[model samples]
Target: MIGILILAVLAGGCRGGSDSGDSRDSGHRPAGGMMDEGTAGQLPKDGKYDPVITLTYLRPWGPDVKFQEGEDQDNNGHTRWAKDKLGIQLKNLWISPSTNNAFETKLRLSLASDAEMPDIISYRGDFNLVRELIESGKFLDAGELFDQYASDTWKDAVEEDPTVWYPYMQDGKRIGIPILDYAYNSDPVMWIREDWMMKFGFQAPKTLSDLEIIMEAFTNQDPDGNGEKDTYGLTFGFKNWVNTWMSDAGWVFGAYGTMPNQWNLTEEGKLEYGSISPGAKQALEKLQSWMGKGYLAEMAGWYDEAKAVEEFTAGRAGIVVGPHWMPAWPLADVKQKVKGARIRAYPIPSGEDGRAGRHGTSIANGVILINKDMEHPEAFFTYQNYLFDHFANPEVGSEFENGLAGENEEAIADEGDQLTNNAVHTEGYDSEKYTVTFDGARIPSLNMATLLKLAYGGKAVTPFEKKVKSGASREMLEAAEIVMVQRNIAMNQMFTGPPTETMNMNNDILSRMEKDTFSQIIYGKISIDYFDTFVEKWKAAGGDQITREVNEWYRTVNEGQ
Candidate 1:
């Protein structure tokens, strides 16, 4: 999980040149205004359509950050292009500079006040906020609207897996649109320092025993060649949920053929909780032994997701486990921190039982919510459908790359253009000759995996893309490509649906039980003999109810699909 924390301020006030035309005619209408039917249907016939409509948005990412004018490739690029090409202006009603607490605070304030709710709320924060928004009854049922008005492309996406709609559905009606991504939602791989491995003459670990040997060597052999045995074997941040632990540690459990926080069907065809299974006990025992040997990070519990990556960046640890995108941002900082440092990624090591599998959390954070009072929900759907067809797919040149320098040469006009900006001229850098040459190329479409690849010398059209592309080395690219290939072997857990009635009501007790049992087992405060006692207490603390509800949801989802 990406740690929900406040980010540092990079730039000051907005720096881009403002649009100076008449404000009223620029498609950005004030709240509570209407567009005529003639204006709604007046899109360009060449498939380059811009419907003039103003929509307010609530974003989890902050407002102060500007979309890179000529070179940035991201969601912000998509939004900006929509304004330029489609005349659909999206204005932020509120922006959370900090992701976790700050985001929650602003959302609550918005809900409490009677101020007009935004046309769209693309939430990517706490699940608790999701539940609150759904219960508020202020949002329109987007599921029903989607079925009625969604484009064929959008419908195909939703129909492929009914579970995609789970986060938005309420009483069988959809209330939000989910932003989709391919791999990061589930699969996690091991990232290693390749330069250190080469120095120490070690290969990437393939099995549990192999991993142990490597970890021991990493700890004792002084892989860094600093002559100081201060380096630890593996490091990860684990604080909030078992899922966070399972995100990285689950690969170890997979060696034993069990996945935590899930219900695995037995040979008898009975669904059983993985955490309570005997396999889990064995996995925990292994982790405990490793902890006892000081192979794992000592302060893992105190660190959050962001800080865990810092360990590897600081050169205090050798291996970090995360999704394929780790090389792009968090892990990419290693080269700056340590001269000539090279990071490589490998598949999760196979377990002791010869089983190498991955456990995936099928659920995403939340879905896009529409204000109940908003009259043009269909327009938003149309806009998103266009985005899906153009940006997400490989067939269309993205709007973000339109009319910019180097775009015509580097971008494949037929295939969707990459989000690399190629503009060399900044606002005031070269004024005289390039005065009217301000290139406003759109950003590229990027998911976590592609971003990682692009970071490591892959070609992209946007200038920002080029910057990141230049940062990564050949070794990094090879490692990222390898991990990308292994993504299919990962197992997406069948049950990531919401909690059942009893479990939801007793969540506090259930959470307490999980924390107490796991902490006690790890600290040796309770013997492994107490495992059975913990199981019984877990059921009493609402585990049993959770199982039944989860199974029911699973059955419903499969049946619908």
Candidate 2:
């Protein structure tokens, strides 16, 4: 399940969108935006289509997105730029708000009814839907089109992690172009209460035993100074899944060498279910011990990710694990509640072997498909190329950085001495999200690498770097440094393709059973040996067949590569 990632900064500002004087054509080839003479019917020189080209797509409108009084989805600043600057016209076939999965429902119905398909589709959720679209035979070979039309920058970005193409591959042809995003965006790091650490005279944990000692102190020592036994050592939610984006307990399993709820590669180079591994049993034993010592919250089994984080934010827990972005979010609430409260990010504690591992994030968040019957297929590439070249990482003091001519001065003035001049959206408008694809465009690893550079005393000379420096806090910089230092240990999920037949039939039942049994063992309602019985039952209930199917899919994809 890949959720759409909202970029921290708007990728494109209001620079070229409003200034391009080119006019739209009533026909396919308009007189305003044209190609060079004698190059007719061929790829254009500067991505300008010459005669205007119309690319149609369905719009998944966001509830939070606002439009200027005179502008709309069809006549916004971004759409104007496509018409005048790039000689492309974006046509929305229909509009559907994103709430309640409205867009996905419409698309599914379209597929089932064989409705007229748009020229291109930018989908950002559900790999299963992507697979269904590809299997429908309504889309073209995206790899072929990309190779033939994509700019060097676009090609290089996709090549950064070639595995991004795995999910969209069919019959040895890549049928979808992945929408790239920053890597390691959700990998876990340790966040500890600095005031509590100082009160307890503790240092950063270097090993699992060290972490345990800190947890015990936090649980029993009343680190909050309220003189009540209400605080816990560490906080995480395990009700939905052990491994998750927030309030994650994957590090706990990582401490023992496996991450539950994600497929991991074994020593023999075959994919295996992490929940059934020997390391998982060992991890369960350790969790049971922690439960006995009351080191974890008593409400863990009932808490989801949001509920679990409240344990830390309400100042009832001393530690929480999450991504580097925590300081900018719910974690910041602690400062307003606890006087003189200080929080800091640190590396995940090593296990007994002096090593650690945690769940890794994917670089590509969504898939973009092209309809086989569409005319002007290359126009999509041209529009995306322009976005990647300019807005992906805008140059300092450029029009993109300066924004609209009038608003530029005020936006720059707000930076103070930093001279951060990134463009600001017009009131009631965000031009980036109004483009053909959500969040406009991005280059994988660019944003994080820039943060890492600033984290270690590197200069912020570029606009992108300055933007990062202006937005990131000292704690976030330090967290980025810690994240990079532990990058090698990230255990990325290996089975990215759609679920297999056995998985479709038995996954829900197996997942419930696993969660129930694990929680029972941790709560002491069942003996640790019950794990052995659970594993045997899991195999009998289709876990073995699912493993075989996953490996077979893995082998086929790898062999295709």
Candidate 3:
């Protein structure tokens, strides 16, 4: 229907919503999107679309998204909020379960079959798939459109880290609007069972050799005291690669002054493949030796993140490494598994030179791609700017400072009420703003930045940190404390060069080779010196060409930047 649509949205729990879409309150007034003849052909920055526009969108999450009593994904507070505020109603193009990679997997079928796709899609994971989508010639160039319609608020957000757009830019044309997330979410930390360390009378490790000593102790000291050798010193998944977001092994090389699966700048200012650095050779030899000494879990190579975390949850692994939030899920399960099990967080160990490196992703989460043929490119920007003002970065007295002023306004402020769980209010408000980048979201306030400031500042805890501490087991609190310290010293990779031409064509083959070779060297299937041969083979198989192109792109994107 072209008429306005408004749906009732209920509220949810008192805790901050999911990491994706949290921290939204409410606003007043139904706004406009399009303009009338008296105003010529133009859209209002803060009003509803004059001609109600329905956008076809793909929903990645199924019932995983909480909704109010009368609201579904397609007819919820979020949809109603958009319609009333921007006159942009979202039609559910299709819904796919995000779990187990189902969403992307199904979308790929459409992409390959030339099936009709949605007008707008917000995707995360498998960036290569995103690149494929762009090259499909189905998306619009968003640069000029953005420059013409982006609000000052949205502009400031992008300027915070402009490189976020570099990946979606093709041939100087910005084909995508980047979805941004917290910078520190991907930082690495070492998660060890503090009870085990205390039981063994071992202190936290400071250097690589100290880590080796602790690992040896964890393996042989019977820290679990079950009178059976059923535990491992360390556990992490290496099925995909040696590095990952969680359960990562990249820090091992970082301790030796390198990070595999990244490009590092040489003293000569040339881009050097991290895997070929001398530090990687030493780290691989160390891992091989550790494997021989029975310090590594036997299932490490075969495990994915879910499976890798099981050993730790099941109380068979003493150490796991990942980002600061590990205690929220897989580690949380550990408390249920072992009555006294205490997981604590620490910084990844450093080398003798006191340098450390960790695997990381770019600040951007995903991008918003629009259909090239869509006539309402400016419509998308108008909607996004509205979101930026009201939900993403609401100023106290702005038009959208309050959530959409519809039927639910009375219920939105009732935080104490337990009935409502509508998305306009309950939806992970934080993650979603970024989800619709083209229309538009922010770096949320969560990343523990405030908690860190309070913990180190010696001031009384704020309500948020107090909640972070409430009912938290002493061990969990201590882990959070340690994370506050780790945040300061962690190093993220600076180079995020776009995929080179050679990379786009040969990356699969090359990545497989490197994975196989690296795993072999660590597993003792290949000698340490084989890494040298693998390096040459990789360079010959297009690594060198990719390197040159990547350098050129880096130089270009960063010109005068």
The candidate that achieves the highest TM-score relative to the unseen native structure: 2
Per-residue alpha-carbon lDDT of model 3 for 335-427, expressed as tens digits? 898989887777678888887767654568778888876656556666666565444533334333333332333223222321211233434
Cα lDDT, model 1, residue 54: 73
Model 1 regions lying over 4 Å from their true place: 1-52, 67-84, 112-115, 184-186, 245-247, 263-271, 361-365, 394-399, 402-481
Q: Where does model 3 exceed 4 Å of error?
A: 1-46, 66-71, 99-101, 393-440, 444-448, 457-495
Give the per-residue lDDT digits (tens) of candidate 1, residues 427-504. 222111111101111111133333454534345544333333433445455555554456544555565455567866
**lDDT tens string, model 2, 40-129?**
564355546667778898757887678768977788777876787778889888888888999999999999999999998888876678
CA lDDT of each candidate?
0.58, 0.77, 0.65
Q: Can you give the lDDT of residue 372 in candidate 2? A: 97
* Model 3 Cα shift for residue 395 (angstroms): 6.4
Candidates' TM-scores?
0.76, 0.86, 0.82
Best by lDDT: 2
Judge candidate 2 against the unseen true structure and give its global Cα lDDT, from 0 to 1: 0.77
Indicate the residue-level lDDT of 71 in model 3.
58
* Winner by lDDT between candidate 3 and candidate 1: 3
